[model samples]
Target: MIINQSIITDIKNIIVQSKEKAIRAVDHQRTLMYWHIGKRIFEEEQEGKERADYGTYLIKLLSEQLQPEFGSGFSPRQLERYRQFYRVFPIASALRTQLSWTQYKLLLSVDNEEQRDFYIAETIKNNWTSRQLERQIYSNLYERLLVSNDKENVLSVAKNEKFPSDAKEIIKDPMYLEFLGLKRETSYYEKDLENAIITHLQEFLLELGNGFSFVARQKRIHIEGDEFFADLVFYNRLLQCFVIIEIKTHKLTHQDIGQLQMYVNYYDRMEKLPHETPTIGILLCADKNDAVVKFTLPENQKQIIASQYKLYLPTEQQLLEEVNKELESFEEK
Candidate 1:
């Protein structure tokens, strides 16, 4: 029997599409299974309100009984995780199937309800992978947003209380590139770091937070006779604008701000769609002096922002220092 070539190609496409959907279905079912298991465990452990001691003992006993049969995923620590998971995602029906266990795990670690909800919405909106979700949460995307935008604006964005017309809504103060594993002490060229980020672009985008779609690497632009290249170009669907990122391997400077401003202007004037909002510029640098940045930029500067980057995660003491500093600033305000 002779098979028609066109029919054969169509059959192959159908098979491929079917397989993809089947895999997604399997993943969804598996996630639901885990959630239901967590729910069961949580309900069984809840003796009464204000019964932490009793709950702890119950988890220990439950783990001991379940561990041998269920293996490592059912250990005492994991049981506690399950309980916390249930608490974080109380409504099983509302839990997104697209999100993996790792994403859920990362989300459960976050204590801020508004921030958590923001991430959840962004995750679903962006279809972020688990690794991506972990990186954003680790980078303290919410805190970065708070520092970058007005307090009222930031909180409103987090709660989805209001939507902005521009990319400014989601632009963070500091774009964390810790996943690149670059040394803090060793000096490197901006291009070198930019190349590395390009190589690990997926991880970098995830760290950059939600709604970021890579548009170009070393995106070129010509002004009069001079040539300039943006370190990275991305489109944020949530914010609805082109994001021009200028990567600096060294300390941020006024020149960096000037370059980014020029790029933002070019995109806004020459490239932006009639319906699209203005382009947002970000200067991602190794180190930043907040006072210097404040003085360097014009007062009432709305578009350009300089953010400090860190290679490693902050320690508990560092986090405490940040909190205390923010509190002090709040008091002064």
Candidate 2:
């Protein structure tokens, strides 16, 4: 009997897709079930509010009963987490089916509503996994952004409430490169850092900003007397511009800014389409003095930006101080 191999392939694909959908459906239903449990427990606790230790008692008793019937999935700690989830997202409509319970648990850990909302928006927008959400939260991406930009604007851009008008709205200062797996003690050349970024390109893009697509690395440029190679070339679709990055392993100098500005000019003059915006240049350095960056660029500078790169994630106290210093630096201008 003649049998078509294509049919077998099609059937296998169909089965795989169906199973995937079924798994997602089951996960979503489980999330809803958890929300329902939380809501019901909260209602009961509210009803017994006048009683001493009523909320605690209600949760403990419910956990005890649920554990035997449903097994340890309903442990007191888990039940408490579920309750907290419902509390955070009281409006049932606010629950996103796309997010799994694990992602929701991460969101529940975020105390600030604005920060939580930003994470939710980013997670859904970026289709981030629970692990990605955890990394952003632990790295203090929200607070780091707030250091340079207004909270409402940051959230607005993240939520797609408004399109970003300025590069500052999207680009981060002191972008974290810890994911590149470079040690703090180790000194690296520009070529080494560029290679590391290329190897970890996905994570680097995520850290860079929105809508970044890598164009090239070590992209050669021609000039009358000299040739130059841009460390990284990227296109930002949202901004509709070319972004040229130059890596500096040391603190930025005026000459570095000048070099980046030259790259920006060349890209804008030669490479950019007339309909596209001007090319934006970024000097990614290990350390930078804002004063040097400020004075080195033109007064109406919008295209060239000097950003610092950190090898390691900052501790809570260190993050606080960095944010404060950045805020003060901004205010000074």
Candidate 3:
């Protein structure tokens, strides 16, 4: 029997979509099953166990028996993971089946309940993969978000709900650049840094946080037929706008802000959708003066954001100092 062209096309489309749905359903079911298994194991382990010996022996015996049968996935360490998984995700209903075990494991690392919840909401909202979630957590996404936003505002953003229109509302301070793998005090051309970011684009996107999709690097823009190249260009799904980024190897300067503003304005007028939010500009600088950043633009400026990038992770003391200073400043204001 010969199928009509339209009928064949429709059949193929239906099969493709059905397979996709089936895969997602299977994954969700598997995740829920693991959760249940973990919960049962934890409950059994905790039943009238006031002693450490029973717990230790139980894991050891299970590991020995399960390892030969089930192999590496059932090691003693993995059993501990299952136990901790149940502990961390006590409420099975609250678990996001779309998120993998790796993402949930990362969430368990966050000791703060509120912060963990925020990341979880954002992860689900954005449909981030395990690697993406890990990158955001390592980059201190929650702390940076909390820098200038109040608890309510931050929570709302994390929940993919409405957020106030402010530069600080969207920008992550001291933006993590560990993906670039550049050493401190090293001199590299802007092209080199851009290439590194491109090489590890997924990690870069995670560090950049939600909504960013890379459009191009060294994107050209024209003003009065004079060409200027943007270091990077991205479109933010959340903000529904273009993001023009400029890279600066030196401390952020007034000139850098002006240049970025020009690009932002150009994008707004030339490329932005009429209903889209204003184009957002970011200056990724090696260093920044917080006071200078405050005074460089209009007090109510919402389109442009300047942030410092660190090649290596900040020391705990440095992080503490920055956090304390920001908290103090907030208190003063």
Candidate whose lDDT is highest: 2
What does candidate 1's lDDT look like per residue over 1-333, in tens digits?
Answer: 786899989999999999988877887776677778778877776645367677778878888998999899888888888778777778889887767777778888889887887788768766777876776677676676665356667666655678765454565555666778888678888888888888888877777665679999888899899888888899987777888888887777787787788899999999999987778888888888777777877886666767667777776577557756765675675
How well does candidate 1 score on lDDT at residue 27? 75
lDDT accuracy of residue 19 in candidate 3: 97
Off by over 4 Å in 1: 1-57, 60-70, 149-162, 216-221, 228-230, 237-240, 323-333
**Candidate 1, 105: how far from true, in Å?**
2.9
Best-fitting candidate, scored by TM-score: 2
Which of the two candidates, 1 or 2, achieves a greater TM-score against the reference? Answer: 2
* lDDT measured at residue 239 in model 1 versus the true structure, 0 to 100: 76
* Cα lDDT tens digits for candidate 2, 1-333: 999999999999999999988887899889998999889888888899999999889889988888999999899998988788788889877788888888888888899999999998999999888888888998888887887689999999999998887787888887989999999999899889998999999899989878899999889999997889898999999899999999999999999999888889899889999889889898999999988887887797799988889999899899889889888987877
Q: Give the residue spans of candidate 2 off by over 4 A.
A: 1-16
For residue 158, give model 2's deviation from the true position in Å: 1.1
lDDT of 2 at 221: 94
After the best TM-score superposition of candidate 1, give how far the Cα of residue 261 lies from its true spot, in angstroms: 3.1
Show where candidate 3 strays beyond 4 Å. Answer: 1-30, 198-202, 215-227, 266-274, 313-321
Instruction: Supply candidate 2's per-residue lDDT for 116.
Output: 91
